[model samples]
Target: MSTPASTSANQQQTHTPVGLIAFAWTLVGVPLAYGLYNTVKAASALFGG
Candidate 1:
């Protein structure tokens, strides 16, 4: 049901840029890592680890 041009456009839209993917992961990962590190530190202190 799709024409060639429209198909190519769809394909382009579906493909995400590598930089954008990395940036998104970094945006989420930094905060997640920070929270995890603090949690582990707190747990260690609580348990005398």
Candidate 2:
């Protein structure tokens, strides 16, 4: 038996805003870049100085 229309699957899509996505990336990328910079600095110190 087919389901009722009230119980049917939704066809609409939810989208994130571009500004919000950019803000989220900036939030994640800044600390990630900082951590990578620190790791590279430590590795260079260990290998050379």
Candidate 3:
């Protein structure tokens, strides 16, 4: 009765949806963090602190 090996190959999905989202978030977060850091540094310099 174990004659069908094709069922196991087609039953699973190999795509990861969360991993793709995390990767995208990291790509966008790097530049955003740099912008925030520079903004704070500029403010401090303006006040002569």
User: Which residue pairs of candidate 3 clash?
Assistant: none
Task: State which candidate, 2 or 3, has the greater TM-score.
Answer: 2
Q: Is candidate 1 or candidate 3 better by TM-score?
A: 1
After superposing all C-alphas onto the true structure, candidate 1 shows an RMSD in angstroms of: 4.8
Between candidates 1 and 2, the one scoring higher on lDDT is: 2
lDDT of 3: 0.89
Model 3 per-residue lDDT tens digits across residues 20-48: 98999999999999999999999999997
Better of 1 and 2 by TM-score: 2
Q: Could you give candidate 2's per-residue lDDT for residues 1-49 as a string of tens digits?
A: 9867654365566899999999999999999999999999999999988
Residue 26 of model 3: what lDDT? 92
Which candidate, 2 or 3, has the higher lDDT? 2
Highest-scoring model, lDDT: 2
Q: Cα miss at 40, model 3 (Å)? A: 0.6
lDDT of 1 by residue, 1-49 (tens): 7567666556644678999999999999999999999999999999985
